[model samples]
Target: MRIIINTGKGGVGKSTISALTSINISKRLKTLLISSDLAHSLSDLFAIKLTANPTRICENLYALEINPIIESAKAWQNLNSYLRELVKNNSLNDIQVEELLLFPGLEDVFSLLKILEIYKEGKYEVLVVDCGPSAETISLLSTGEKLNNLADTLVPLVKRFNSLLGGFIEKKTEVKKPKDIVFDEFVGLAKKLYELEKILMNPEITSVRFVTKASKVISNETFRASTLMNMYGFLTDCVYINMLYPEEIKNSSYDNLYLEERENVDRIEEFYPDKRVFKIYMKANEVIGLKELESLNEEIFSKIYLEEFFTACRTFDIKSEGASKIIEIDFKFASDKEVDVRRIGNDLELSYLNFKRRFKLPDTLSSRKISSYSIEDEKLKIVMDYD
Candidate 1:
């Protein structure tokens, strides 16, 4: 199954683009479009009320606005109930306990869990995700990996607590520590998270599309987003400059806006030179409903297969070059400017003007020094010194 995720600045009409893209996909494949954001627009866009349960939009097309809180309640019910029973003296109501049980930004993770759950059902050919804003979505895509790491450390402590609670804590009610039930649930969640990372990081299974307006600020944010997308090992295939003004209009007062917006696209093209860039012209009226979305889809994606619209280059790879080693990365999005590179022991840090990620190199490569870096065939090759 193919997963297409759309994210951008909060008001770049990403939902509209997602609607259009999913409508187009549903024409050829069984598709489900999910609004995974807290503030939803799919209902307004589709002009139909929706719930966590998938609602049919058209033949072979389904859409829903997922409540991550609700998903979390369902998934973590045993754990939450056990905790509440264990600490009944804490003056917190069920609602307050529910809120306290939720980790910061865990709703985002729950949103992904929702995606993973549906993806495993084997019903749909494609799942189109209308993600939250770009920054938050970045956090969402990478949260699985980070949370898994945290779980590895936290699970043992939880087991110890479960043992202590079983012996010492007086049970006010029939509820126990729930170690078996909790661990089973935890294992189930961990499995889902592993699948989540596996699917999201796989290039062939997932494609991320960024939508932005044609302006310097928004385009630059999109550029930084592209860089982060690479850092987290997610694939970014399309960058859409939405709501672009046409070159011709009768107003001389708006000439400068038009010229600057034109330059904005040029800058974005140079920024994302390798990726397919799409320009969405400003429409006279709001593009809503399946009819209008179908019309726009025909106007936009007429030339090639929808699959052709997605592309992702290598993010990070290592290889042996003679006696030395090399790290190959797709820094094409940040290649035009000075990218800061530094090494401290086995950790390598690559920072563009604004964003970067530090990586822990392998133990075998710890003795090797960073010799040099150069862009060869659109890849940033960082060579390690053997001597």
Candidate 2:
């Protein structure tokens, strides 16, 4: 199955593009449109009430607006139930137990795990995801790497506690099994999360598209997001420049605004030459529902070929210049953020602000020392020494 992930900052029209694209593909493929936004963007866009359950939109399309709590409950039922039981046993109320158990972004990451479950079910041929806001999308996509929650820190301790005290406890003791179950469940969740990361990074099966309006403020943010997503190994297949001013806007009172927006559009195209940049002009009437989406379907699908990626390009590359290996990291727009680099064995820990991504060095580079480094334009080039 093919997965198309649409992400952008709030008010960039991601839900619009995600909805229309799903409707167009549903004509032939069994498509599932999933939205994690609590604002009910999908529901409002389609003009149909949707719930955590997938609702039938048309013959081949089904849409679901996820409740993050429901998704977390489904994935972490055992752990959640155990924690609640432990807390309730302490004379805590249900509300108090829930308050303690709920972690910020726990359900958000759980909703992301739901994508892997849906993909494995093999029921739908296509999965269109309306990811959360751009910043949240970055964190959510890195769930596997940054899964250092309470449970994560507690896993090893829990497993060790069970292992140390197991011999003293009776074979039929129920407590031992529960402890083991907690570890097992956490392992299961971690495995699925890693699988989700793998699928998202796979260029052949998944493509991430950025949706943004043609405005300098938003374009600057979009450019930064593109740089960050590349660092995370997610392929930005194309960019959808939504809500452009129509021809009639020329020579009108809004002409200058239109002209400035046009320049932003051209700049975005130039910034992403390898990626197919498509424009969607603002319509005279509000575009909503299936009937209204048919015209937009032609506009988007006629040019965007879903079967293959808009471009298959690697985010980072290594080149042999004489003897040294030059490692280039696409780290533009990241200048605003301070970076701290540390090496642990053969892995490089790239830290910037709150986020840290580990890059495993190749054998050739692992044995060598980083002789020098420089930031040229958008790339961070590192020189590896043969000595």
Candidate 3:
């Protein structure tokens, strides 16, 4: 099983949750924990020096922090060199060429590649990933499909153009044509991304745990993040709200603070009614080292079955009713009053409270008109008629 811990904002105890979860899993099963964040803190959290290579932390636990510079040198030097040459040949300055050669999501791509490599090894029973901040994590998860699409559409066109213009361009600018190795590199990347996509989309093998704090800013970002994850077909099993004040401090000097936290907690529950929400109170001492992390893990997830905690909710499905097709959305734990639906081009946007989920309509449904829509049995059924 692979678990990814993610959050929209930083300093929300995401790394803490990931470490404790890994420790808990390692207690009973062999587990590998990976930090995909560029600004890594897993080593600090564990109080042990770590590197890009996996280091055995204990009997059944292993950990690694992805160093993008090292990983890029290992897996992306050829690709980067090709891009640099291409840019330099275009009459661009050295600074401009260098900037272009440093691809935006190369690190994220390498991170997924690393995960795929470890997962395929089949040496560990559980894999826990401490993902980067929300935007980068989303980009990393979406990179595979984007790269595959580019390979299918842009790569062949570029290759053909390069072949046709090689001699002419070389004579004009004294630039060398790109070798076959560059195209081979592109093909290799595409294949790896395709494999990673399959593993990420498989709910039985992977699940995402979203972490946030009980505040307006974090709560709002959490909703948007969860909606986007669902859009990409990633299953979010739970939402962890950390650093909550304990009830004992309710009427103390922190009464107002507790009230605000309570309100935010309620708001989160209302927003993500279907997800399991776990609140971890602020610890008396800083949570560090294996012993403290293990205790924290027990406090948060002692009776919880990590493997069986969440079954991915089937969000939508297509069905046949007589000669027409119907699109059914499962809005379990939600009500008609809570949902507002609208259509934008070929996409349907469903909003509940402050959370919005958008679904792209298939060609069959996009060409047809909505005949009727009804909410029944915790489902929003939209009947589509043949155009």
Candidate 4:
């Protein structure tokens, strides 16, 4: 089982939730907690220095903070060297070319590759990933699809063209062709990405949990992030709203703040009616270390089983009713006014605010026409006709 904890905004106590959840799971199962956030706070939260390598934290728990720079040196040295040579050949200075070696998205790519490797090792029963902020997590989740597409299309073409060019260049010019080792490295990388996609798209094996605080800004961002997660075929089973002031403080000077927080909490509950939403009240002091985290975990999840908490609703399903086919999409937490739907050729385009997704029609529905659509039970059901 893989659990990825993320938040739409910073300072929402995401790492704290991640740490405590791992501790809770490790009590019954062998668990590994990993921080893929560049600005890692897991070390501080656990009060132990962590490196790129896994460090045993307790009896059944281990932790690691991924350092993408070090991982790049290990996994991307050949690709970086090739790009550097190409840049130098174009007359760029060494300093500029060296700076260019640190490619955009390399951190996310290497972090995911490391995750794939660790998950395949089968050493741990459960893997808990403490991802970066929501935006970065969304990008990382979508990376598998993008990389798989490149591997299937671009990488094969590049390999064939490079091989042909190598033979021609060797016969005509003194220029050195790229070595077979470089092409082999790329092939291996592509295979890894393809496997990663399989792991991520399996809803039974992986689920994303969103952590957020009670605020208008954070709530809005969480809604948008949840939509994107659904678009990427990731199951979101729960929303954790953290750091709420205790209700017993009604007579205190912070009454007004509590009132506002209550309103925000109400909005969140309404937004995720289909999801298991957990709320944690703020404590008198900061939460840190295993002892405090264990208490925190109990306060939030004592009533439920961790394994049962991961059971999620399907995002979309296809069913045939008599002569017609129905495609139902679970758009819970979203109103009809907030969503836009259209048909583009053989695909369906769905847009919610700033987020948009295009889904290809299944083979059975590819030749069918969209007879009608309706929003019912917070679900968008589209009817297609065989004729």
Candidate 5:
């Protein structure tokens, strides 16, 4: 399924763009548009009230304003309640316990869990996700890997440490130490976490699209979005340059606005030279309600004949040349930046400017077994074991 996640610096008109994109796409395909941000404006963008559950906004379009606060309670209620008990029993202040309930990872984790459920439903051809800002969005995608790896290594060690501590205390006080309820809760959480990661990294089922402005400050968000997308194998298909001023503007009063748009798009094009860059003209009024959204779509996508709602490049083809396997990585969305390649022990490390990722080698592979590496046809091909 095509998963478009629009995010960047706040007040970039993400909600409006997200709604219009979904509306335009739903015309041709079954689409599910979801808002993952706390300040929900999908309802406002559509000019129709909505609920947390999936609600039909149009013929083939579904919109959901996911209330993470509510979802967090539902998914983690059992665990959170258990945690609260421990905190209260230890004489921790109630306010502190409540604050602890709203942990850093719970919101992101619950949001991901929501996405997984929609993906499993297997109903929509495209899932348009209006995600949180850069940091939260990146955390949502990569947290699965990080959390899984952490739980795998730390849980057992933590359990063992708790056991040792419990035994020592029990012997000194001549009283049985209470069961490690916290550890058991963690183990339970770890299992659920593993499942979440599996679903997120399923390449066949998910992809990410970023909405960005053509400004210098916002460009940093693009760099980070690119770096994170690569780490999680998320194909960032399209980067929408929103609220661009027209080239025909002659008003000196608004010249700076037009100039900035030009420079922003130029900068973005330099960064993502090969990938398609779409520029949406600045509209007069806020894009709310179906009528305004339709007009906005016309103004923005007029050059594209209003055809497909999304733009992307999907190229993941592993070919065998004689005795070697060549895995090609697409860098179409990446500029002509210098790519750094090194062998850090058993992992192959590749980094370019703000982007980097490590690929672990299997037992059959050799460091020198890599026959060659080159960028051709907008793809980076790594040949393994070719004589």
Candidate 6:
């Protein structure tokens, strides 16, 4: 199955692009379009209602708005019920048991897990995802790999400890199984997760299409999103530069906002010379409902260059060196001044002017003490020292 992820600056017509693309693709292939953003308007765009399940919209199209609470209840209800029962029966603190259910990003993680469920059913040709804004979307995808590894290591230890504790605490009682089934379930979950990861990392089967507006706030954000996704092995296929001002206003000489917006388009193209970028003229009316969305799709292809698929020719590497790990990030544009850097616990944060990003240490490097850092060859070098 093919997976297409659309993410860009908010208010850049992302929902329009997602709706239009999914509808167009569905005419020729079976497609499942999913929106993970909290402010989802897929229902509004299609002029039909949507829920957590894959609701059939037309002949070949299905839509879903991922509801994490609903998904968690469906996927983990058995496990959670067992845990809650065990804790309550054992007289554990009520607050502690309740708090255990409140893990951060459980919803985001569970949303991704649902993809595996659909893929396992073996029913669709393409999976189109309208993910959250850049930060949360990338984080949502990367969390699975880290979690899969964590489950692998922790499940065994947890099973052993549960068995030892249960045996020692109640010698007269019948020996209870260590809930080893949970660990087995985790293994199954991890296997499915790993398959999804493999699919995303493969450029041939997966691609990211960015929908961006030509204004400043979103223009800069699109640039950063492009670099960040490329750094993480998600291949960006093409940039859909949406909402361009029409040149008809030039005769009236009312304002230069249109001219300024035109220049932003040129600037974005210059930043990524190696990739294909497509543009769309600003609509006369607001884009809403199925009719306008269909018009938006019709306007796309005539201006689009089919040969210019998204391409990535740069690499960012983070390597371990003794106690510290060195990160080397290369960007197409040069920094005019010293780039800003800050270390917060195990995460290294970097910023240049208004652009900022944070990265955590790899498992192999997080435990080491960072001795020193430097920038050379357009790469950040970090030396690690043993305590």
What's each prediction's TM-score? 0.83, 0.87, 0.82, 0.83, 0.76, 0.74
The digit string of per-residue lDDT tens for model 4 on 323-372 reads: 99988877655777887777778777777666666656778889988888
lDDT (Cα, tens digit) per residue for candidate 5, span 176-219: 55456656655666566657665555555555556788788887
Task: Please give the lDDT score for candidate 2.
Answer: 0.80
Worst 10-residue lDDT window for candidate 2 reads 170-179
Please state the error at residue 299 of candidate 3 in Å. Answer: 2.9
Global lDDT of each candidate = 0.80, 0.80, 0.77, 0.78, 0.70, 0.71
C-alpha displacement of 306 in model 5, angstroms?
Answer: 9.2
lDDT of 6 by residue, 222-259 (tens): 87766566545567767888878777876567458877
Q: Is candidate 4 or candidate 5 better by TM-score?
A: 4
lDDT of 1: 0.80
lDDT of 3 by residue, 190-249 (tens): 778878887987877888888899998988777767655665667787888999998998
TM-score of candidate 4 to 2 decimals: 0.83
Ranking by lDDT: 1, 2, 4, 3, 6, 5
Off by over 4 Å in 5: 88-98, 167-204, 251-253, 302-387
Write down the worst ten-residue block by lDDT for model 5: 305-314
lDDT of 6: 0.71
Name the best candidate (by TM-score): 2
Q: After superposition, how far is residue 246 of candidate 3 from its true place, in Å?
A: 2.0
* Native RMSD of candidate 5 (Å): 4.8
| lDDT by residue for model 1 (68-138), tens | 77888877877877787766877878788777778676888788888988988989999999998998898
Clashing pairs for model 6 are 237-310, 324-384
